[model samples]
Target: MQAPINIALVGNPNSGKSSLFNALTGLNQKVSNFPGVTVDKKTGTAQIVPGLTANIIDLPGTYSLYPKSADEYVTYDVLINPDNADIPDLIIIVADASNLKRNLLFCSQIIDLKIPVIIGLTMMDIARKKGVEIDLDGLERELGVPVVSINPRKSKGVAELKKIIDLAARGNYSAAPRDFINNGALAKPVTDEIKKAVPGKSDYAALHIAVNADELHFLNIPQKAAIKQTLQTHQFNKTKVQAEEIMQRYNRIKHIMKSTVVETDPLQKQLRSEKIDDLLLHRFWGYVILLVVMFLLFQSIFWLASYPMDWIEGGFGQLSGWLTSVLPDNKITDVFVNGILAGISGFAVFIPQIMILFGLITILEDTGYMARISFLTDRLMRQVGLNGKSVMPLISGVACAVPAIMATRTIENKKERLITILVTPLMSCSARLPIYTMMIALVIPDRRIFGILGLQGLIMMGLYLLGFFMAIFIAAIMKLFVKIREKSYFIMELPVYRAPRWKNVGTTMVEKAKIFVTDAGKVIVVISVILWFLASYGPSSRMQPLHDKYEKMIAAVPADSPAADSLDKAFRSEKLSHSYAGILGHAIEPAIRPLGFDWKIGIALITSFAAREVFVGTMATLYSVGENPDDNNATLREKMAAAKWPDGRPVYTLAAGLSLMIFYSFAMQCMSTLAIVKRETKSWKMPLIQLVYMTALAYICSLIIFNIFK
Candidate 1:
């Protein structure tokens, strides 16, 4: 089979590159790690022509070919590495028409790579609103590449862009006619030497190799040695060479803009975005608004999701009962109903909350408020020795820590990045939502404060805030010890506020919900089955004697009498107490008893070490091990609510529930998280240290809370 054309969608951050990628590929995209790097790679198959599909690799949005962060380095490697598998046959440069001059800087750099390039101009609507205008024909003539105007948000001009891509695929599109800048003139000695050493590259590509040779992983030791020797021999001033190249490129861009573009003078009037920023970015008011937004966000999690969550819970309850009745009384039936079904329903019931959380977050992202949030939180971030860049990764940690840790690659400062990575797990990710929600519902009353704020909602918001503040506190302490000092700056572009794209929000909700159900669900299901078996069966020596005793006792009584039923309950309870899961839970119980966890909760703690969400399934399986799904249509919540100790004290008391929630909040329990941390830090030491510290922190905090509340 012939390989599909490899197309790279490249642009600056917030430059509509992602929008265009979504428009071109629709629902055909998948995200994975780039080979040999932990950075995310988003690839999709886009049909450029009838039966001619292109594999679109959406490279990280970078400001320039010059690399700084790990993200930019990845883009640089793919474009500069001659032997890379992702080298594009055609490059679709998504440029923001609203920021044409700055956008062109990167575009011009790519053009000098001498690849088949097509400029897809986005945000034209915003540009026109800002009194900026562009002539596509003139831009095409000057840049010597096809320029297609597109509004990816509305899917406008997408067909035209695809048609141009088809033209390029047919070898009908012209590459850049001339060098965007005089690449050789910038550093003649280094460029010439690099070109001689690394044959068959563009003059600009050779120049990149000259400056970035040592950092480029693709270059062999000999090639690197030769380039290094050449640079040393020529006394190549890389800084001067880069400055000269940028200046000359902008000088040419000025002339091109004179013919191809027109824009309002900045001093004449502020853009609408700046005017809005005045209010939204106000220090005091911005934080006030952020708090209110958070309050509403947390409130919506329960308010919007309550009905659906209840429906799902009820639906699973019915399904479990139906399966129990219809299927014969056997081990397979027990596993199917009490194990697999219970496990699925565990995470499944929380899908509504997950969807709402991601959907609302997507709304914040689409409207561009998320960027302002980073700006708003910059001052607070700096207090802990991080800049605005760290806010993004920390915010992303609320979704998942693995990718959030991967996101730290964008944080250029090693000290700040390391601190951010270590503390990010403290941010309560969506994985913790199920346990928090369940526990909150169990402990906090369904009442309102001041007749407006629901008590339950406030507690939920408080937990999230607790995680954030905890992360900040941890970061501050680590900031003192990390020792490495580097000057930090928070350079960021505030994209203009736009209406939330409902379709994109919907897509994100579905995508996140699907991930929770599939990825987390798999682990939860497997663990649930295992837990059910351990809870259902035990050592024959211990279990069989109790079974015989109960059987003889019940046989002497009337079969349908309450005494017979009572003996049956006692027998099942005794069987569970002696089971393998029971043994494991009991062994850990003495260590955890101070934190208000019983043997059943202890079992959950051990199982959920694999994943935080597995706690929900663990609870479902443990409590349902010997209970008949048909005899009891009670929801998992009710079953848990009725749990008791031998002394008849309720297990789900306020103090106990809150203590468990507190423990989960602080615990570094997820094995996957530890593994990813190891991957990101490229060492077992940090993750191990992180695990130990977090586990100790969780235990100490939980002990304190349990004592205080009890």
Candidate 2:
């Protein structure tokens, strides 16, 4: 029997670490939060060979062992702390072969930690494309550790890497034969004292403990105090010591590279990607290109997805009709057909748009244009008291606020990160896309703009841009009030532009659509069923009188006559108006009447508090419940268009539809988002304040819009 060993995949950000993890582990992976932090920890089981299995943990990337952001420190602790549950039994350092010198700095630091190490080199192809060549054997001999050049994307060198890992595990689990730098001599007294505090580790590990003791979670109060006392006693200077160590490591690496690598000539000329960036990164044209790209994106959502959306709507309508006719006429049948089927159709019809949105976003990320977007927006982000790093989260917020807020872990500045979180939900997430789409269809005419652009899509783009600008505007206001001061810099490396990874894009599309179905579907179904019950039945005192009146009216006419059908219709509508759900909606009607919302709209507004997407299902179930049995084939849009108030005005007029869209845009209606905000900020106070301010803002905006349009 062999014990399973923990193997950590570590590297700088975008250094092919995650790609390698996926290559080895395949589908045997799950993500969970790291201990005491919101950062995701991806772990999987890898069958290294027939009989050998390893636990692979993909740690957050860092440029060095030093701690900076919350997520970066998670990597630091797992590697440096001896008692960490996730401390790797063996570390596979994934380094980019193209950027060997810069990559080696972190690699050498890890080598000196004396953990059993293997250098899994990546990006050899990229290096060769730049006219750089490497002698693998010479580099292996120089570093005194095995160096395996791997192309994780192609699954190249993985078998050999696994054999080496297995051999290393079976053998001594040895560290590098020689120290990359003489850590003991860097600061003899401080290193020796730290050795006592965290005993039996190498000098490099001891030095790290001395520098990072305060940030290390594994250290107790006494251990920290002792380390601090020792540093004070020895007059230790972290900056000087670290600076000297880095210089020494790089100096040694320079000698190693001279013999083992042939570098590209500096005057050889710019790479293809650099040439392409000339236009993509241009100040004037770049902005124009970005706008054109966005306009096309929104247009595609309508143009390409319209056919599939229509098919889904038609399929669901037919399915509902068949079930209604085949099932026995009873309360249970009505609930299933109207409550469950209607709710499912409401969101299911929007799956194509959701998929298109996420798929396009994934393409932007895959093609490397996403990073340039941050670069382009950096100057503007600075104007709002944020750095370019905040731009990623804001852009990601278009998919969902939970992940977008989580993405703030990458923003190092506390004030900027907090402001980013507070304003991110203002960006219209895909959940709101459903609302926007429905409203656009309901109110906006389906005509072309500038003879080509679809009016529906153009309006949709305005909503997204409106949300983005509003986020920026709110962030600027929060900047003045937050009052946290910290220095931060945004240094981004633009990856060479590559063709979109179509496979990754497809996976993301399926995954995102699945999430919409499973997560949003559950909420929509539950709300729909509950609304059906409330709308279907009323109190006995209110219902009995109506039933008696309708029964006599029905007796006055033939059962199959058109007059009899009309009386049944009047009975159902009157019955719904007096139902419990109707009573509740009327109760809140006065408060929302200024926004052109009636009791039915009020019911939707209340039920959809669980989620913004639930509004669609709420309307579906509400409209489906009281309709004539024979007219069940009418689509929701058609039904809503024909809906009228007691005074004979349309319920979803241009004024009302616009007002609803405005409310959903600014309202903090998603409980899941608020929960994540609370988790990220670790305070109910911030999310609570956010909820109050956003809801108030939504109400005011909707009020003003309704008044103007009415």
Candidate 3:
């Protein structure tokens, strides 16, 4: 049996760690959550040779070995604990060649683990373009490790790096050890005690125990008494001492880099990057560009998806009509047509819009412009009591709040991360778009608000801006009470401008779409089916008597008169719907009366919570159920416009429509978001809080709007 070698891929944040992992593992990677934590664990297998394999674990990105947040703590524990099931036999520390000074801080810490290690120097091309020269051989000699320069994005130098890993794993290579501390005075006493205790054990193991007293578990210490005595004798403050030693190693690494590395034109790249940054990060122009870009993004989602949405609506309507005509009219036929098929249609219409939005975001992220956005927005975010990293999650909140909350894992401060997660759901996600668009089209005038901005567009923009500012205000208030001492620094790497990677972008969009369709789709389908059954059948024999009376009345009408023909058609349609079923809708009619919604609308609201897009489908189904069998206009909007309240008012008045839009905008409606939040938060508590807060807010706001308008 051939044994697989374990290789741990470690790096600082934005050091091309993920890119290298993707390059090595390709399609073999799987993302899972770490045990008892929401932070992601990415693992994969790579073929080191024809037969041998390497199990690669891409640890969460961190700045140093020192653990700060929950996510970073997991990385430190996994690397330091030998008892871990997935302990790596060889550690690969990837570094950004352009940012060697910062990257080496992590490299120095990893070398202290005493494992066979290799350095992967990534972004060498970027470094070269900046006119920096690296003496690879000299740096290798100083670090006591093989250094392989790679461009993972281009698949350059990957093969050579793999060869170096193979050699290290096969024990065909050895280099002189790099020592950060002299330890001359301390080593004499430590060596004598180690000689007396273990008697000719490995020198590295002795040195490890001497320095890393906190890592006694990693050494598999068999005797507690002996370990205790050794620690007492050394007077070890393990964490502090280890940190001090790591800093010493970093100093040494910095010294070597200063000597071996040469800069031919140091100011050229900095001058160019700075000049471009000035305009992009300008206080006034930056805000203008951001607003314009966001407006364009929203417009693109609506305009681009219009044709496909119409196509889907028409296709589903035609299919349902044909099914009703072909199948025998019975409960079984009704269940299949109205229950399952209608449910599927409810969720499918929004696919085009979501796909377009996700595709655009992927391009922005891959092109590295998103990082610049974060930097540009840092000052404004700070006013809201959030760091620069909060910008990504807040922007993501526009598409969906669940993932936006999950994205807060990147924030190292516990309080800041928690605050971000709590407030992100306030932003209007795409789920709220259907309600907003429908109401805005009907209620808001298309006239300009200052002869420049369209009134309807301005209101839409104001809603989004309101939510964003509210999130900030809430975060700032929370920050005043939460006592946390963690320091934050803005040190993100600005990757060189490059064309978006089409393969990665496509893969991300497909994966996100699949997750939404499958996860949220399941909940919506079930809710739609249940709602169908509720609206189709009712209790008591009251409906039967009404149906019989209506039929008799229709039969008595004069056959040649136009009034008689219209009355007969209406009578039959009403009788058929009321027979055993429509009365149930009437029963719940009072419950939603306060919000100006009838029983049918109430049913739609309940089902739409599973997904907001289901609102249109529910309306379509309910209207079709009450229409004459021969009626041709199957459009929900047309049917809705024709509907009336008991007082003879239009069912969908401007006030009612606006109230509904506001309700959906504020509500926690998507089940998939709830599910993701549950997964990311690792408990029902946080998601439950979000659910309650958002739902209550929605109801109260809608109630106020409806009553005021009434």
1 or 2, greater by TM-score: 1
For candidate 3, the lDDT comes to 0.73
Worst 10 residues of 1 by lDDT: 625-634
Estimate, for each residue in 16-45, the C-alpha lDDT of model 3 and write its tens digit.
888889888887888887776667789999
lDDT of 2 by residue, 248-331 (tens): 998999998899998766454577888879998898999999988998999899888889988888787778778888889999
Comparison by lDDT, 1 against 3, better one? 1
Q: On residues 670-699, what C-alpha lDDT tens digit does candidate 1 reach at each position?
A: 988899989888899999989998999999
Clashing pairs in 3: none
Q: Rank order by lDDT, top first?
A: 1, 2, 3
- What overall lDDT goes with each candidate model? 0.89, 0.89, 0.73
TM-score per candidate: 0.97, 0.96, 0.84
Worst 10 residues of 3 by lDDT: 179-188
Clashes of each: 0, 0, 0
